[model samples]
Target: MSTIVRVAARGDGVAEDGRHAPFAAPGDTLTEAGEIIPGPHHQPPPCRHFPQCGGCQLQHLDDESYAAFVADRIATALAAQSIDAPLRPTALSPPRTRRRATLHAERGLVGFTAEGSHAIVDMRECHVLHPALFALVAPLRALLQRLRPKGRAELHLTLADQGVDLLIRGRLPDGLAAAEALTGFAQAHALARIAVDDGYGPETRWEPQPVAVTFAGTPVPLPPAAFLQATAEGEAALVAAVREAAEGAATIADLFAGLGTFALALPGRVYAGEGARDALLALKAAAALARRPVVTEHRDLFRRPLTTAELDRFDAIVLDPPRAGAREQVAQLAASKVARLAYVSCNPSSFARDTATLCEGGWRLDWVQPVGQFRWSTHVELAAALSR
Candidate 1:
C-alpha cells in the first residue's frame, strides 16, 4: 500500500512513489489494486453530486487539509520560479458564501455542468452557493420548463446590493406572454435586474431600479456580466492585504482596476486604469459621485503598459490582473522606481512567473497572503507584497 502524502494542483492525491489517486485526500492509502482507503483528512462529501458536478473538486477534504492544499499550491508555484517568501495562514471563505455563480439549464435540468462533460448535473442541492443564490435554482428550473427552451441556456447569478441580478443567455419563447412571464418571475423573486441575451446582446426585461455593487463603501453601477469576487470575505481579505502593503503611500496606481475594488479602498490619491470601457466608466462615475480622488484612464496595459517614467509617479502600486497575469505590465514595473507593490492574482503559476521577473529587477518579495474564495475547488487567489 502506498500512502498519499499530499494533494496535487489538480486535486489528485500524490503517493511517495509518484503515483496518483483520484478523489483521494492527503494521508489516504492506495492499495495495490488501486482502491483508496480514506484517511483522517477525508470526509464524506456533503452534496450528492460529489465527484460529478464540476462546481467543486475537493469536497472530500476537511477544512484543515483544504487550507493546506491552498497554501501548498502557492508554495509550489513560487518554488517553481526559485522564489521564496513568508506565506501567511490561508484565509478560507466558508461554505455557502459564494455570491456569484454560473449555472446551465437544458431539458428541464438546471445546475453546473458534469465533470469533464457538457451534461448538466441537475443540482438538487448545492453546498457552495449562497442560500439566496441557490434558492433560485428550483424556480429557474420551473421557469425554464415553462419557457421550454429548445436549446441550452446559461444563467449568471450575482448578488447585487439590492437583490439578485440574473442574466440569461439563450433563445426563449418570444411573445407578450413570454415577456410577462419573465417580468413576473423577476418581481416574484424581487430580483434587482433580469436581462436576456438571445444572440446579439443583453436586453433588460425587468429592472425596478438601477443595479449596482458596493465596493469599499462606494456603489458602482453594475455592468452586464461584470466581474466580481466570488465571496465578500475573500474580497475583504485581499483589500486588507493591499492596504497593508501600500501603507503610508500618498499616491497609488491601481492597474487593471475593475470597478475600483482596490482603488477605492486604498487611502490617498488613486489612479485607476482598466481596459474594459463599461467597467472603467462605472468606476469613474462612482468615484466622481463619491468625491474620491481617483483618476480613471482607459488604457490596455497588455498592449501599452505604463512606461517607467509614468509609473515612477506613484508612491505605491496595486494590480489585480486576470488569470493570465500582468506579464507586459510587470515588465515595466520591474524596471520602474516604485517603492512598493501589492500584486493580486488568481493564477499562482502566472503570478510566480511575474514575481520572478520583478525579483530579477532587484525587488524583494516581502510576503504572500493565500486566499481560498472558491471553497472546495482547485482555484486559488493571493496577494503579495514586494519592495525594492
Candidate 2:
C-alpha cells in the first residue's frame, strides 16, 4: 500500500516513497492496483467544470489541504537552497475573489481553456471569477454569437475602480459596422472601458470616465492592460508583509515597482524604479497627487540593475519582480550594504534561486509569508524579509 503524503508542485499527489498519483490529495490511500482511494482531505469539487476547466486543479482538496500545499511548495523551494525560516500560515483568497482573468473564445464558446487542450470550456459557471466578472459571460457569449467571429479570440477582464475593463484580442474591430457593435456592447454593459486589438495593440473603443485602481488608499490611473495583482485580498496580504519588512526605514527603494503598489504605501521617502513608461508615469502622477515623497525612475532593471554603490543610499529595499525573478538585481543587492530587504515573488523556484544568491552573500532570511492569490491552483506567491 502506498500512502499519499502531500501534493506536488504541479497538483499531483506524491506517495510516501515519492511516487506520483494523479488527482490524489494528502492522506489518500492507494492499493496494490493503481487506484486513488478517497482520503480525509479529499472532497467533491464545488465548480461544475472541475478538472475540465484548467482554471483550478486543487478544487478536489479541502481548505486545509489546499493551504498546506501552498506552504509546502515554498518550503520545498527554500530547502533546495539550504534556507530555512519560520513561515506564517498560508493566506488564501476565497473563491470568487479573482479580479483579473483571461478567457479564450472558440467555436462560439467563451471561458477558460480546457485542461491540456486549446478547446474552450464555455463557462456557464465559474467558482474562480468574481461574481461581477462572471456576470459578463452570458452577455459576451451572445455578442460573440451575433458577430460570428471566424476564429480564435481572447478576452481579458479586469475590475477597475469604476467598473469592469474589457480587452478583446485576435479579432478585427475595424469598419463602422464593427465599431457600432462594440459601442453598443460597451454602453449596454455600462462597462468602465472596452479595448480591441488585432495583434497590433489595444485601441480604446469606449470610455466615459477615467478608469483607475486604488492602491494603498490612493487612486492611480489604471493604464490599459497594466500589470495588477490578481486578487484584492491577496494584494492586501502582500502589502502587509511588505510594510512589516520595510518598517523603521526612513528611506526605502521600491525596485521593479508597478504603479506604486508599495512605493505609495510605504511611509517614507520612496524611490520607485520601473521599466514600463506608462506604469512609471502613473506612479509619478499618483505620488504627486498624494503629495508623498516618492522619486520615480524609468529603468530597465533586467538590462541595467542598480549598482551596489548606487544601492547603499537606501536603508531598506522592496522588490516585487516577475516570474523570472531578479537574478541580476539580486546579485547586485547581495553585494550591497543595504540593511533590510523585502522580496515579493510569484515563482517559488525562481525566488529560491535568487535567495540562494543573497544567502551566499551573508544575508539571512528573517521570515516568510506564503500567499495563495489564485485559489485552488498550483500557482503560489510569497513575501519574504531578509537581513544581513
Candidate 3:
C-alpha cells in the first residue's frame, strides 16, 4: 500500500513513492491492486457529478487538505525557481459563491463539459455556482430544448448588481415568437440583461436597464463577456491583499486593471492601464462618475511595457496579469525604483518565473497570500508583496 501525500497541479494525487492517482485525496491509501481507500483527509463528494463534471476537481478533499493543496502549488512553483518567501494562510471561498461561470449546452443538455472530454455533463445540480446562477441551469436546459440549437452553444452567466446577466452563444430561430420567448424568459427571471450570438457578435435581446457590476463601492458598466473575478469573496481577498501591500503609498499604478478591481479600492491617486478598450472605457467612466482620482490608459503591456523610468514615478505598483504572467512588465518593474509591488496571479508556474526575474534584479519577496477562489479545483490564485 502507498499513501497519497499531496495533490498535483493538474488535480492528480501524488503518492509517497511519486505514483499518481486521479480523484485520490491526501492521506488516502492506494493498494497495489489499484483500489483507493478513503482516509482522514478524504470526504465524500458533495455534488453527484463529482468526478464527471470538470467544474471542480478536489471535492473529495476536506478543507484542511484543500488548503494545503493550494499552498503546495505555490510552494512547489517557487521551489523550482529557488525562491523562498513567507506564505500566509490560504484564503478559500465557500461553496455556492461563484458569481461568474461559463457553461456549455448541446442538444437538450446544459452544463459543464465532462472531465477530459468535450461531452456535456448535463448539470442537474452544481455546488460551485451561486444559487442565482445555478437556478437558471434547468431553465436553460429547457430553453435549449425548445431552441434545439445545432452544434454546441455557450452560456455565460454572471450575477450583476441589478440581477443575473446572461449571454447565449448559438443560433436561435428568428421570429417574433422566438423574441417573445426570450423576452419572457428574461422577465420571468428578472435578468439584468440577455444577449445572443448566432455567429456574429452578441446582440442584446432583453435589457430594461443597463447592466453593471459593483467594484470597490463603485458601479461600473458591465460589458458583454467582460472578465471578472470568479467569486465575490475571492475578489475581496485579492483586493484586501493588494491594499495591504500598497499601504501608505500615495501614488500607485495598476496594470492590467480590469474594471478597476484594485484601482478603485486602493487609496490615493491611481494610474490604471489595460489592454481592453471596452474595459478601460468602463473603468474611466466609473472613475469619472465617482470623482475618484484615477487616470486610465489603454495600453498593451505585452508590447509596450512601462519603462523603468516610467515605473519609478509611482510609490507602489499593483500587477494582476493573466495566467501567462507578466514577463515583459516584470522586467521593467525589477529594474525600477518603485518602493513596493503587489503581484496577483492565477498561474503559479508563470508567477514563479517572474519572481525569479525580479529576485535576480535585487527585489526581495516579502510574503505571499494564496487564494483558492476557484474552490475544489486545481486552479490557484495568489497575491504577493515585494520590495527592494
Q: Which tens-of-lDDT digit does each residue in 203-261 have in candidate 3?
A: 99989999999888999999987899999999999999999999999999999999999
Over 4 Å off in model 2, which ranges? none
After superposition, candidate 3 runs with Cα above 4 Å error: none
Cα lDDT of model 2 by residue, 1-388, tens digit: 8899999999999998778888899999877686889899999999889899889989989999999999999999999988899999999999999999999887679999877888888899998899889999999988877776668888999999989999988775457887898889999989999988877888888999988999878999988778889999999999999999999999999999989989988998999999999999999998899888999999999999999998999999998999999999999999999989999999999999999999999899999999998999999999999999
C-alpha lDDT values of all predictions: 0.95, 0.92, 0.94
TM-score for candidate 2, please give it. Answer: 0.98
Q: For candidate 1, what's the RMSD?
A: 0.8
What lDDT would candidate 2 get against the real structure? 0.92
lDDT for model 3, please: 0.94
Please give each candidate's TM-score: 0.99, 0.98, 0.98
Model 3 lDDT at residue 27: 90
TM-score ranking, high to low: 1, 3, 2
- Candidate 1 similarity to native, TM-score: 0.99
Cα RMSD for candidates in order: 0.8, 1.1, 0.9
